[model samples]
Target chain A: MHVRGLVDGQEFLVKHANGLANGVSELQHLFPAGSNVEDSDALPVIWEKPEEFAAAIDKAVAATQKFVAAAESGDKEAISSAFREVGGSCRGCHDTFRVPQD
Target chain B: MIASGARRLAIAAGLLLQGAAGAADDDLIAQGKYLIHAGGCITCHTEDADDAVPLAGGYALQSPFGTFYAPNITPDKETGIGNWSDEDFLRAFYEGTNPEGDAYFPAFPYTAYSGVRQDELLAMKAYLFSLEPVRKEIPEHDLPAFMSSRLAARAWQLSYFEPARFEPDTTNSSAWNRGAYLVRHLGHCGECHTPRGTLGALLREKELTGNPEGADGESIPNITGDRKDGIGKWSLSDIEYFLDIGMLPDGDFTGGSMSDVIEDNTSHLTPEDRMAIATYLKSLLPAD
Candidate 1:
């Protein structure tokens, strides 16, 4: 759902402006207390560095909010830039916290 | 006299504009720099050291034949390609032959490079020459006697190598042609992705269908339209995203040599070019 929102461009963003914000905010709550699955691709770095993980989540949330604001404004360029920021935040988190699949 | 002076000023302005245009055209170094990423020269030419000098060339490429050490491509007169003439460089790429006219080992991927345009090759040479030369003499390849012979390379070429330039398909979009040029010539993705014959010749019929064993003996994934084995389900944006940041559709980042490739090559390409690659890949027929 998040991937679609991120890659599907303005139509999806405009349609799911509120839903996108809600979905992104849910990311912060994803790593629960003592929630570690054996087959999960989430790296141990996410758990080992709690503060850093939280910071990454904060970045995502901020970017998502900016995207929502751009969607509301109906400025095409602003929305695109905000969307790119959102993607950048996702990349930043993944680079550090996600295990690479073969 | 006043009219004559004004005419002279106009002529001078015209000359200045022409000079500016020529400068833009002569920026082959910049073009070559971009093409270098397209060629993926750094990944092979540079050693794995964090502070490794670029293109000094000590990377060990392990193949079925043997482990081949990449040579110094820097323009150092004695140790690098500085002494090589333009014709020598072109022939190396075009025929996989050295300046002495001896066949180069297939490990060099000169078979794929053989298809590159002469102008582009010249630009690449220009860019390489522009670099600060690093005088690093790499050791020779650790190969079996049979494989070490230049005759072996010549035999391999006779059987499998066919030198040709990229012929753009007029029926296809310009993007597709660009993609084909990149994949077939510059990127040389087939060198690892495609299955190889006993002689280490790429199986042209099964290009980009994926190799069971690739560089460093890793299993390269099929990138064709095969739903089960290939990237059939990946959207163009998904592929673009993967190239840009090494993120798979399932949210996992890529690992291994591909990870390095993403960092040094694909990540630097323009988004439009990435999309072009994706488009071309998607258009391929599904291969089992």
Candidate 2:
């Protein structure tokens, strides 16, 4: 799932699949430790701004699910679409909090 | 008198057949010229400066592993591939092994070429043969001593190499198959975008995910739809337009290796071909 140095295509897809699964797990980690649920790092603002953050997360989860399914079925078209969804979620999250690297 | 007439007629027919063969060769050579342009031979072989001759080779390709000298492939009888037979040319491409039986460094991009059609490769040969022979001599590669031995290359090929041809995916549309063939063979895009291992072999598993340090220290971006790290924002039209005119969807013009790529390869391809490439590329799911 580590993105830093991966280059192989098969491994990339496998890693990506794991990462999407992990993203679902990590969604909980976005919140800060020891604070109220509202004060977590992942920002309940996601829930607060239901239209933006919630929609983004929903799309990401859906994409990840589709990605896993398509990849499993060997459907390239569906896999590609799922990958785009995953990208959307990452961009949406970064746009909210992370700086652009390029 | 009848026997004499029959003999004359036979000679005339033989002459006609020879003429037809010559014309066919000429037509094949012309087709090869077109394929060569699409194959991006000029981009790597020709130096950027005015002194360089197209397809004469001698350009230095920089990679994280080491510098690879694109050899003179022009028809120079002594320095180039001019003296190489059709078999030699085919083996070089199909096997990624050099004429000397030494395994070529993957820097040659033969992995992508492994899928090319036989006729297409022959056409490339024909086009290359038709060029005005250039006599410029290129230098040997400056690899580290440990990596310089051809035996090491032989071992590398033994372990990693798998010679194969382009197998059309029967379920896919013809456009998709053509795109796959072009991307995998003629385009050899994976040679740049895919990451290589310590010995300069492509990590086939990581094909086209992206290479941070590829040709010339450029960060070859992940083409997969990783929104944060890849081109997930791009539409199919965006991809096609970029290939067609080297313009990004945002209207910015590219200036580096991609610019040269489009100019030499994708730009010359038909619009339908470009769209197919776009379609195939856009189809890769971004790694999370």
Candidate 3:
């Protein structure tokens, strides 16, 4: 949900975070199941399907790592595609595990 | 030899006429294929599977009304629309009736389809006929007894529906007009995006602001000009790219039913058409 406020095309707000090797994951935090969390968008499937959820996280981690490298490389074209792929990786998990917002 | 030359010229003329006719058929078929995407036929009609046949039609749509299983639309004689004439196809959309005069349930979204012109419907039919036919029988809808009868659908149509064609707003730009036609009729974005009334009729005043209860019991987001509730911050390119690939203005990609729409419908549209849709969406008044 932290990324919800960060609009696409305008990454200037979080531009300072670019130096981090895993900037994408730096913003992502998955609370443990049964934690005292309220108003969380994470669905029960995240806990129920542990293996699938873990696999999804692995994919996202790799995507974030690639994105970090691309951003640091200073290659505009590569950065754009990597950035989009990172979003795709997040969506792969969100589709099943996140409660859709109205 | 002079007589032979005249015969050869006659043969050449005959071939030219035949080529022109063949080209017309090809053009009609091509346009129809594009319209199929614009009309969102593939997304609903084709079942969700890696090997699903195009337009074989077993996709299910979950609504407050019931779970509607889209029937086979292929040109197969046994289970598809092979026997439907041009008029039969037109009546289905324009009047929301089957070839046998039975009223279809509101799940079909023909209320929005009513605005489509006759020629386009025929072209769409022509395209369907050109495809390889598949014989697939669909399941009956699971509906409550009160709404199960065809009479119920007929009554609903009489009360809440009006068959209307698109009227271009003369004052607006041509692109805007095209966008209006595509969004209002062909694309039928309002079917999911627009909030529905008690009887499942779309609420015109609350158009495109969003729906809490949408397809598959998921909430659909607002795309109006409201900064807080809608996509007011998104530029035209943002909306176009979103439609193209299901990526949200947020660095995250959108998923669920909309992902299917992006893959089957908007992704296939030309950049100009996507931009037109973006322009039209941006022009709507913001509502709370």
Best by DockQ: 3
**Order by DockQ, highest first:** 3, 1, 2
Give one digit per residue, the lDDT tens place, for model 3 in B99-213. Answer: 9999998788899999987888888998999999998898888888998889999999999889868999999988888888888999999998999999899999999889999
- What C-alpha lDDT, on a 0 to 100 scale, does residue B237 get in candidate 2? 72
Using all chains and alpha carbons, the TM-scores for the candidates as numbered come to 0.74, 0.70, 0.83
Q: Which candidate is the best by lDDT?
A: 1
Rank by TM-score, descending? 3, 1, 2
Q: Provide DockQ values for all models, in the order shown.
A: 0.15, 0.02, 0.31
For model 2, what is the error of residue A35's alpha carbon versus the real structure, in angstroms, after optimal superposition?
Answer: 49
lDDT of 2 by residue, A1-102 (tens): 111112335556766686766676566445443433543334445545646655665666776777677666555556655654555455456445332222
lDDT per model vs. reference: 0.82, 0.73, 0.81
In model 1, which runs have C-alpha deviations exceeding 4 angstroms?
A: A1-102, B1-26
What pairs collide in candidate 1? none
What lDDT tens digits, residue by residue, belong to model 1 across residues B171-285? Answer: 9999888888888888888888899888788888998998877767677888888989899999888988788767688764566677767777887899888888888888899
Q: What docking grade applies to model 1?
A: incorrect
